[model samples]
Every structure is written in structure tokens, then in C-alpha cells.
Target: MNKQLIFFFLFVLFIIYSFSVYFSGTTYDKGISHFTTEAKLGKKLFQEKNCISCHQIYGLGGYMGPELTNIISYRDNDESIARAFLKGGTAKMPNFQLNDEEIDALISYLKYIDKAGNYPPKAYEITPYGTVNEIVTDEK
Candidate 1:
């Protein structure tokens, strides 16, 4: 009887865990759904251009260029500057020869990325093992 009760309890716990894991939807769905049509095209262009080779999104790309996660907000939402830069590359940056529409699309994508989240997160804690953990807060 004792063994049977233990098995029944374990089975119940397993079912509850499985149900929760399957039903608890992810948080990313909201962010992903916010992507505009232009932003989607820009995302495709970004991947095609291999921009990650030089630029980073969330500090995960090469160090050749600055992180661009919050560029739209950092630049005070100045699309003109970004457009000009895309139109003509700087001394170190190469011009991709993107047209006005492409530039607009890219800007839209950047805007989406900016709204998604912040990089170098506002808060973090260093673990005893020397690894850093991002601290999440209720912003909304």
C-alpha cells in the first residue's frame, strides 16, 4: 500500500509538470508578433548582408563595429542619419549600395530590434563562479 501511494503521487506530479510545461506560453510571441512587414524584409536583408560580421545585435557579433541593439533610441530616433550612413559608407565601413527602399526597410528592422529589448542589460549580478547573470525587472 505504501509503495502504491508513492507511485500514484509521482504519476500525478509528472502529469501536472507536463501540463504546465506545455501550456505556459513563451514571452517572445508578443515581441515577434510586433514585427512589421518592412521589418521582416529588413531582417532578411540583414541576414543576406551578413552584417553580423561587423555589427552586433545584443553583443553577440564581432567587435569591429558597435553594438546596435538600441541604436534607433540612442540616436534619438534619427532616421536621417542612419539613412545617410547607409547611402554612403564611412572610411572604415563599406557601402552596400542599398537603395532608398532597402534603407527604409533596414531602418524599420532596426526600430523593431530597438523596441525588443536592451543590450548590456540595465542590471546584472556576477556569480561566484565569475559568470554574469542578467537581472530582469518589471518595466511595464
Candidate 2:
């Protein structure tokens, strides 16, 4: 393998690792916590910045990227998206420079939306097989 290709691959790996750490750091349940103030501010930024211009959530905005309603589950963190937004990608893509707080606020707003929207209750049980039951249901 060529040295140039090896260097390029390593560089890409570094970028990936950096993004993963940054984004994961920002994700947390913060259950029942209210980011209303931040969300409100973020909403204004969302509209003003025309994020919906290309992205959608719960059936609104342009049809470019995936819906952002549950975007946190999609990307590792805001840093990844922010980096993508600022660094630019393909020809059609554009860069938007926003500081850390702005990105955090946006993420907070998105998390608020996702929580309000509700998800299926989680259930867990021990299982052994499909054709045979490890434990039969109790009957009275």
C-alpha cells in the first residue's frame, strides 16, 4: 500500500474518532428535565437559520435530509452535525458557522421534541427458544 493512502486513511480515522467523542458527550436522557428556555431560543435559531429549509421533523420543512425530530438517536452528537454543517460536504451542501452553545441549544430543543412525542414503553423478559418455552405462563 502507498504511504499517501495510509496517511489519508489514518487522518480519516482520527476525524471519525474525534466526532464520535464530541457527539456522545452531548447525549443524555436528562429525564423530565425542561429545556424550555433553551428550546425557545433554539426554535428561533432553527427558523431564522432556515434549518427546516432542508430538514424536516414530524412532517414539516424541506425534503433533503432525514427528519430531525429524533435526530439525537441518529447522529452521535451535535458536534458531528455541526462539523458537517461548518466543514461542508458535497457540492450542493453549504457550511454554517455556529458556536458550541448554539449547537447545544439546538440539540436540547430536538431532545425536548423527541421526549414530548413519546416512544413505546420498554419491556424486558428472559427467553430461551421460539419452539419451546423456558417457562410456561402461570394458569389459575
Candidate 3:
């Protein structure tokens, strides 16, 4: 009887856990699919150029370049700063010799990505349960 009761309790806990997990929803942005025409072109260009080899987004790409996830916001939303870099290139960065239209498209894509999220999250707490909880705010 005790074994049966324990099994029944475990079954109830499993059902509750499954329901909670199903209703929690996803943390990803739903608007990610809605990119502008220019941004879409930029995404294609980004893949074609293999920019991930030198740069990272959300800390998932190469470490040779700085993470670009929040670069637009970090640069005070100055598209010109990024434009100049792409136009002339830096000492560490090679000049891709991209035309004006290509550069603009890339900038637009970066702007769209910037709106997605931040890297190295602003605030996070490490729980005693060995889980990290991100504290989201409306600062942006």
C-alpha cells in the first residue's frame, strides 16, 4: 500500500510538472521573423560574407571580434559609427570593400538584431538550486 501511494504521488507530481512546462511559453522573441527587406538582404550578406568567423552574436560566434548583439545600443544608436567602420574598415578589421547599398543593408540588419536582446545580460542572479535567473527590466 505504501509503495502504491508513493507511485501515485510521483505520478501526480510528474503531471503537474508537465503542465507547468507546457504553459511557461518560450523566452525567444516572436518578432524575430519580421525583418525589413534591407535587413533580410543584410542577413544574406552576413551569411555570404561569413562574418561569424570573426564576430559573435549572443556569444555564439567567433571571439576574434567583439560581440555584436548589443552593439547598436552600445554605440548610442549611431548608425554612422558602424557605417564608417564598414566603409573604411579598422586596423584589426579588414575592409570588405562593400558598396554603399551593401553597407546600408548590413547596418539595417545590425539594427534589427540589436533590438532583439542584450548579451552578457545586465542583471542575473545565481540561485542556490544551481540555476541562473535573468532579471529583465524596461530600461530600454
Candidate 4:
């Protein structure tokens, strides 16, 4: 009798664990799709704002700051991203003074660029801000 009870408990736990895994994976795919849309919007903004004139993504555009294709992998957090964008960099890269919306849009475009494999291999990792910093080590 004890054996049966233990087996039943294990079965129940297994079912719960499987369900959680399935649900989490489903949510992840949906989230990636949604973010992909924002990334597309970002791509458009990147071009329109003349960002490409200075920065290049995936073998295109001018040379300014480093290529942003894999920015997600480099920085630890979005605060870093926001800071860099708002303050710009040393004498060479001037701050564009982009508003919140513009910054968000630009980030999205960088997402698109990153997706295109523009940065060093294995650069992006999935972060908490709507999914960044996700690195596919096996994407080859």
C-alpha cells in the first residue's frame, strides 16, 4: 500500500512539472514573437534617425561606435543601455538626445540588428526587460 501511495505521489509531481515546463515554453515563444515585432520597428527607426550613418549592423552602415548586432550580450542590464544611449560616449560619439520613446524604439532596432548576427559571435544574452540577453550557443 505504501508503495502505491509513493508511486501515485511521484506521478502527480511529474504531471505538474511537465505542465509547468510546457506552459513556460509556450509563454516564451509568444514573448519572442511579440518582441520580434518591436525589433522590426526598431530597425526602421535605426535607419530613419541616421544611426546607420555612424554605426553599422551586419556588415552595413558607417563605422562609429562598435557594431550593435550583439549588444544584448555585452551589457549586464538595461540601465547600462539607457545610460549609454542618453549620455552617449567620449568625444567621438555624441549623444543624440533621444527621448524615452525614441530610445525604446532604437533599442528595438538594435534588437533587429542583433538578430541579424552583426556583433561578435555569442554576444547577446536574454535580460528581464521584455527578453534580452538570450544567447543561442547552438545557433550554428
Candidate 5:
């Protein structure tokens, strides 16, 4: 009887876990949903250049480079971001030597990412059980 009860409890927990995962929302927003041709190309370029090997997006990639989730909003603008590509990176990052078009596309993709939302949210409420609750507030 005890073994059967344990099995039932485990099964119930599994169902709850599955439901939560299914209902969880994705990080992407309308911007990502409506990707432009240039943004698509930029995404391809980003993958082809192996940017994920060093830089991260939404805090999911490598730690060699800084997180690029909101880089455009904080680090000047598109022109400067493009310049970084043209000028190459510091000791840690290598220059890909991307052309003007490629740089533009990359910037477009970055803009889309920036518009998506903040990642690793600035403020969040943590539960005792280890679940993090995002503090969604209107942007001033």
C-alpha cells in the first residue's frame, strides 16, 4: 500500500511539472516574432561566426564575453556596435571582419533582441522553493 501511494504521488508531481513547462511563456516578444529579412540574415551571421562561443544572449551562452541582451540600449547605439565589429575586439574577442551589410544585419538582429525584453531581469522576487518571479513593471 505504501509503495502504491509513493508511486501515485510521484505521478501527480510529474503531471504538475509537465503542465508548468507547457504553460510557461517564452522569452521572445513580438519583435522576434516579426523578424525582418535583415534580422534573419543577422541571426544566420551570428551563428555562422560562432558568436555564441563567447558572447551570450539572454544569459544562455558562454561567459567569455559579456551578455548582449540589452547591449544596444546601454552601449551607445547601432553605429557604435557596428564600429566594434569593424575595429575588432579586445584581447578576449576576435574580430570577424564582417562587411558593412553583415554588420548592418547584425545590428538589426540586435535591435530586435533589445526590443524583446530584459533578460536576467534587473529585479525579481525569489521564493523559498527557489522559483524566481519576475517583477514586471511599466517602463518609464
Candidate 6:
């Protein structure tokens, strides 16, 4: 009888855990799909160039370079980003020698990503136990 009761309690706990995980919501921007031809090409270019090996989009890539989530916002427009790409990156970043069309596609993809959501999560709530939680806020 005791074993049966323990099993029942464990089963209930598992069910609750599963439900919580299912409803936790996703961090990705569902609206940001690479459906357009330019966006798709840009995504391909990004992968071909191995950008993820250094820069991060939505904070999921490598740590070698800075996170590129809100790069457009920081530059205030796409022209700055295009210029940076044209001029090649800093000492750490190599020149891609991408053509004007390729650059345009890449910029389009970046703009889409920028419109999707913010990154580095500005609003953080610090708990008494030193645990930091991300607080989503409206963009200004």
C-alpha cells in the first residue's frame, strides 16, 4: 500500500511538471520566419559564412564576437551596418568580400531579426538569492 501511494504521488508530480514546461512559452519570435527569398538567401549566407561561430543572434550563438540581436538599433539604421560589412570587421572579424546584392540580403535578414525582438534583455530582476530573472519590457 505504501509503495502504491508513493507511485501515485510521483505520477502526479510528473504530470504537473510536464504541464508547466508545456506552458512556459517560447523565447523565439514566432513572427520572424525566413519566408522571403532575400531572407532565405541571407540566412544561407550567414550560415555559409559561419557567422554563428562568432556573433550571436537572439543570444544563442558563440561568444567569440558580440551579440548581434540589436545591432541595427545600436547603429540607428541599416546603412551603418552595411558600411561595417563593406569595410570588413575589426581585427578579429575578417572581410567577407560580399557583393552589393549579398550585402542587401544580409541586411534585410538582420532587419527582420531586429524587428522580431530585443536582446541582452535590458530589464533584469535580481532576487535575494542572487538569482537574476529576465524581465520583458516594452521597447521605447
User: What number of clashing residue pairs does each candidate have, in the order they appear?
Assistant: 0, 1, 0, 12, 0, 0
TM-score against native, each model: 0.65, 0.50, 0.66, 0.52, 0.61, 0.60
Give the C-alpha miss distance for residue 8 in model 4, angstroms: 41
Q: Best-fitting candidate, measured by lDDT?
A: 3
lDDT of 3: 0.84
Q: Model 6: per-residue lDDT, tens digit, 55-127?
A: 8998899898888767876677646765575457678888888887888788877767776767765788999
- Tens digits of per-residue lDDT for model 2 on 34-72? 458887777778888888888876667788865776565
What tens digits encode model 1's per-residue C-alpha lDDT throughout 3-71? 999999999999999888877755435356548999999999999998889999977897787888878
Alpha-carbon runs more than 4 Å astray in model 4: 1-37, 76-79, 87-90, 121-140
Error of 3 at 57 (Å): 0.5
For model 4, the local distance difference test gives 0.63
- The TM-score between candidate 3 and the true structure equals 0.66
> Any runs in candidate 6 off by more than 4 Å, and if so which?
1-35, 124-140
Q: How do the candidates rank by lDDT, highest first?
A: 3, 1, 5, 6, 2, 4
RMSD of 6: 7.0
lDDT of 3 by residue, 9-127 (tens): 99999999998887776544533753789999999999998889999987899888889987887878888888898899899888999999999899988987877757765888899
TM-score of candidate 1 on Cα atoms, chains taken together: 0.65
Q: Which stretches of candidate 2 lie over 4 Å from their true place?
A: 1-33, 75-92, 118-140
Which residue runs of candidate 5 sit more than 4 Å off their true CA positions?
A: 1-29, 76-82, 124-140
Return the clash pairs for model 5, or none. none
Which 10 consecutive residues of model 2 have the lowest summed lDDT? Answer: 131-140
- Kindly report the root-mean-square deviation of model 1 from the true structure over all alpha carbons: 5.2
Question: Cα lDDT for residue 96, model 4?
Answer: 72
| Candidate 3 collision pairs | none
lDDT of the structure predicted as candidate 2: 0.64
Higher-lDDT candidate among 2 and 6? 6
lDDT of 4 by residue, 1-140 (tens): 59999999999999999999999977653224435666667667666777778876666778776676566644542446644764565587777766776677667655544444535644576576767674656331
RMSD of each: 5.2, 20.6, 5.4, 9.7, 8.3, 7.0
Q: Which parts of model 1 have CA positions greater than 4 angstroms off?
A: 1-30, 123-140
